[model samples]
Target: MVAVSQNKSIDGRLVAIGCNYEPWIALLEQSGWKTHCCYDLRTADSILEEYSPCICVVDLSNNDFSLNSISLRANKTKQVKWIAIIKKEQLKTDAIRQFINNFCVDYFTVPIPGSHLLDTIGHQLGMLDIEASSWVEITSQHDMGLFGESKSIKQLRDMVRRVAMTEVNVFLTGENGTGKELIAKSIHNLSKRKNAPFVLVNCSSLARDDEKLSLLDGTYRNEEGAPFDGTLMLDNVEELSKELQDNLLAYLQAPSCESLDEEMASDVRIVATSSADLDAAVANGDFSKELYYRLNVFHIKVPTLRERGSDIFLLAETFLTKFAREYSTMASTFSEDSKQLLLRYSWPGNVRELINQVKRAALLAEGNEVKAEHFDLPSKANLKQSLRNIKDEAEKDVLVAVLETHRGQVASAAKDLGVSRATMYRLLNKHNIVPDVRHYNNGYARE
Candidate 1:
């Protein structure tokens, strides 16, 4: 099972502070919430430890608790999503402001709108089930940073092993920060070409034709003007200009004897990565279809950090240990609050972002443990945006799968998904996927 970060929705279980025998408690119970009431923060913390409830409600409207009492317990928000209920006048207090901003995920003034409170609670509970329920399998640890215990990562690792032994060109695709480069490198290291020089061609930087040729003629060039017998990875291959695309496709299709020069015969294996949708690019006439097909002889979709579930913590721990030793920081372990924040934040930057944030957090951490504040925890607005991204990515996956299952037929996929053709097309375009119904754009088919 996933750690606390990847658990189920709230089990209708809650700990309500300063709300003993109140009308709110009755409303919650009537709504099927198993309300556990506590008078003080200390008592509530004990209950939270025991129950591990998804939510904790602190109703300060009717209670006479001092602001200090609330501030002292703010750290208790480790894994629980805190909802504060206060009188309208308490909004002006600095302590009250800090309590809400620093601890609570949300707050409401007195005469709370019952519906909105319930909605917020429901949202938090729903977040607990994010991309977690489907994966629970664990795989053996790797010495590298691809350390994950989730089923998705295990499958990805297995695929890497399978593909590494082949001689066909590899096409790695995923979000920009999902470590496509690392995957490519891993493939190269495992392949027979491990002894040869592996070269990276940043396709985006090849703005000028001469500059592109310079990499071919410069980086891995032997004395004979031929590239070394190794792998040549085209990073961000989607950005290739039509001219470069033509040249690359010609080079890949040509036999080894048709070298750049009569004296040289190139022996490099091609591996390319694209963060953009080559199908949509091909459909929109933005990329060369021939190059896409040639590079895609073996395709691997690297799983995003969010899709890897509990691997978030695994990566974080790995980065922490590595950087702690390097940076000589005391931040060895993540505090409970930090762990929750790490899981909740959508990690748009993926593993790359996680590494930077962890390294920075470790250096900034004052004590032995890394706290949420050490990572520059997200504001309420940022958290909402991140959560929305998580939802959007999940939706995009569904759209891709449905469309693929129907052999890229938009009408059929739309009907299967119970969405209108227009809606399906809209989603397809939104996710940068184009239905496979199309004509050529000056690129040859492999058949």
Candidate 2:
């Protein structure tokens, strides 16, 4: 294997341990990287202390490469760019896959292409260069509105990518304010018909059955007189009037309408979103079963914010970064206590609610860090917090946590909170968190 020197001298050095050096070394040397290699990691600690590698290549597939030892090393030197090489079958385990994602820059499975490996390594190195140059400047801009890196979110992203590759109709199902419209727009942005119209019409907003049908029919013929052939997002599909539903069924079943030309008929992609459980609604006679089945052809269920608990922090941090800039606030993070409170609370409104709260806290924060008091959680109600009222502050925290747990169900929250129902009612009135009588069921607020 030939050895090539890097253009910029790597001060921290590069280390490869227990890797199949014959193949990767040839590629690395060809790519002009001179790395220090070692088969034994027993003296890795001393070697790391001496060399302090900026990059570490650990081939976990090798029997000699101890996963436990590598994990320890990774924890000690978290800054290093660790690249793991393994067999494809090893990735089948969720734990191993997650561990790699959490710790490594990337992974290369068996049957590796030498050129692809070089390209990936080069790309990762380039990213490091970019990151070190001006991290704040590089990361500050925020137009990519999607958030979350949880396993569920990763799966959702993969699903979105797959759906975006096609021209088929997509049915997005989730609770209200779960960003169903955002998902639709994402699909449109990624599709071949991106340049065309991305129309959105809330089925619930239509005044009458005719109005619902006319909404699509009107859009079919654009203002420029060109047939609108893009993405059509029918929001709140469950709320579509019965006649409108029948018309939609007819369109999906037979896109070749006599009034439509060849180009207009084939170009449009339909995406429908519903906050309500349409399948359950259909079974309960609240929605048409035929329409429900038609829409369910390609379905995606967006998880609620609470369901993705770990993602809350990422979303909160993202919101804070934006709000800090917009509000000209110096608050860069939530206080430790505030962070615990945020994680403990259940987000009924999903991502939308998190954004609202983060923006509010950022604006209201008196210092560089957002404090628990800045949350203004509904349970705080009207309880006046005087400088001497430590008990009130503690009570407010406890009460707010309980209310959020019950989704604003005062009596249930009070019961969990270990207070009498009467006291809970009084507290709710004082805090302005009175449970909505219309939607209360199973000790939780439906909305």
Candidate 3:
């Protein structure tokens, strides 16, 4: 453990809980970040309190530390943003995975350079500053998948935090890809049931009904799993079957966890999400009114990407860079036309589509700049790209035919094609084609 930095003029305060990476610590110190390293969170409170708003990087790459103690400390210190560093293989363990899911706002899988995490740290600190100043007690930014300055996003973030403080059932409505599930998890993480398990039952993809759900008699029993102690998230609730709806409604009415003894009674909060309008579903007689009302105690509507104004650029850039890293591409920026098109288009698929398009663009781009044609744009762009594809295919076919006629001789091919040998080579390289010539005992043959 090391002493807290006395430097008042610094970028931010980083409380390293059980972090033993000295080179990374020195790098932060050199970069004017005040860092205090501690093992087992012994002096975490003092450092966190002094920093006013601090970031903690708990290193769980090794099995030398206790996750229980770290989780307990994190539970007590909700004000501080927590990130984790864990071994990639360690993520396969349920305990480590659950701890990361429950406590960390973000996590990095290591066997990576410490320098690679600098940008993440800096970005998180900037977001934390915005959250601290703009909204009270908004601990996680990326964790909630809500990063925007628009009024709709601001209201949603505020509501998530506010609703998280209470134990009432929450109903979330939004487009399919507007991050409704993230909102539910945020509420669960911020609520009193944070320490308990959060179970999600996706109603849309239910192969079979959960037959062991005992909700009729008020005291609920979840068979084949531990007793329900945390939040129960029913995602895509509009698709819930009639039988499941009855069971869920019964549970909502009684809302008690079955226990071996009366002293161990547990209560699980209900959080439901739907992309469709449940009110209309009820009016159309497609959904149960009782179930709808029970889950709609605190309703929240997530905003779409188009409604988020300048946030599209932020999201696009974030996804582009992220996918670039993943795929090792040179797609660093969007061309001017791409940006204009991005703003003008109404994102019906929302953030999910944006992520997919950007990922595809990044992978497709052979240069640093991505173009509108690379994106899954409207018909005009698609037609232009399709034409270009046709031209490329024709050109490649012509090149192959000429090369075959010339018996794979660059000089003969260049002369026959009336183009420079350099151009011929470039064409072959672009199409990723290689021509071979074979020699026989009597004559020459092409292979």
Candidate 4:
């Protein structure tokens, strides 16, 4: 066991735990991160409770790095973010991996560059400040599902709650992947008819007008043989056919009609979502005006990720935590660079794309921290180049590497790359690269 030492005070109140704190302390102090050193695990609780440091740097390289010790410290100082210093090889051990995963926020492998380590510490401190200052009071019960602290999100939550009280048809407008379906679900779950069926139909997926008319007119029943009574969500309603739109309008005009039966006449709340503007569609003569007016009774415009301000960070952290638990990985947070990339990204696909990227990153990440490259996002630096040069270079490198590995066999290389032989040949020609087939017994040669 490593010997224990009394806590030494530093200016910044950041805590460092380990016997090897001398080198790290000097480096951190030089970088303006004045840290108090605590060599004993027993004194860690008191030191943290007294200093209440937002960040703690722990040395996992010490011989005394045991699961019980780490878990004790983590349990005691639940508020502080722990950064682990470990060797790359140490991660191969399952017990060590589990301990780090359970406790650390981020980690630096041994022989870490001074600049990178400092940047990470600074980022953790900054994130802590952001979290402390931006505590938003979520007003509605369904606000947790909406997941945002921004004014726009709070206003939207209020509107959703107010609208959910009545049985009025609700129209939701937002760009694709802006959680329209989630908002619709929230409304259905919070509404008076929540105990009944909440049916969802993607209008764009219906191939024929007859199918659309049958479903919306309450003629088509789900496999469960139950009628839609709670809520009927027509997703991408702007894609409804002209005939379908007329049928919907007619149904809205007269709830009980000659063709409509008593079961179909039951009050089923309609919640429709559209990425396009129904007003513009009406002006363009694509959508029926009467139908548009009927569905536009109570409209809720879901805000995009960009407009949600600090919500991006909150959502990213939420997704990371969720996927980490799901994938059984230790990645608890993003690196400083990854966080910057997430904030700067335009998120053309919005929350859906963010979830996908985070899930994929968590499953594929090798270490405790998720890095920028794990997201597979295009480099903003090279996006302005129209992707022509970068695309060619990347393609050329792949072709050369595959060809060499397969010993100049085009068919095998093409198969491995998931490209057809013809397309591969065209790519080779475009790059002016010729494959050598001299070793072929069939005597097939390419010059």
Highest-lDDT candidate: 3
lDDT for predicted candidate 1 compared with the true structure:
0.72
lDDT of 4 by residue, 109-207 (tens): 887666777677677777655433332222333224588788888777767765775789999999998899888887876668878777888888776
Q: Scored by Cα lDDT, where does model 2 land? A: 0.69
Per residue, candidate 2 scores C-alpha lDDT tens digits across 1-447 of 111225243433456677655676777776567655545665556655555335666676655655766787776662356778788889887756876976787888876677877776666666555434432332232333245677776667657755675667899988876778887887787667777878898787875544435434434466766666778898988887777777777666664656466655435578999887786788778777877777676789998887788888988998899899998999898899888878877677888888899999999998899998888664332323332365666766666667666766666776787889998877656545546544444222322
* Model 3 Cα lDDT, one tens digit per residue, 1-447: 423542344345677766764777777778766655556455766676677466777777776567887788776564467888888888788988888777677898775466876677777778666656544443435536676777888778767866786778999999989988877888887777888778787888764456434432325555744455778888888887887778777666753434244444556788889989788899888999988888899999999987897789878888888889989998899999899878777777888888888989999999999998898787556556766887999997887777777677767888998999898878788888666655212122223
As for model 3, its CA RMSD to the true structure in angstroms is: 25.2
* Residue pairs that clash (backbone atoms under 3 angstroms), model 2: 381-431
Which of the numbered candidates is closest to the native, going by highest TM-score? 1
Q: Model 2 Cα displacement at 202 (Å)?
A: 1.0
TM-score quality measure for candidate 2 = 0.54
Clashing pairs in 3: none
TM-score for all predictions?
A: 0.55, 0.54, 0.52, 0.52
What C-alpha RMSD separates each model from the true structure? 24.7, 11.7, 25.2, 24.6
List candidate 1 stretches off by more than 4 Å.
1-145, 211-220, 223-226, 260-263, 379-447
Q: Lowest summed lDDT over 10 consecutive residues: which window, candidate 1?
A: 131-140
How many clashes (backbone N, Cα, C below 3 Å) per candidate? 0, 1, 0, 0
**Higher-scoring candidate on TM-score, 1 or 3:** 1
What's the distance in Å from true for residue 157, model 4?
1.1
Candidate 2 residue-pair clash tally: 1
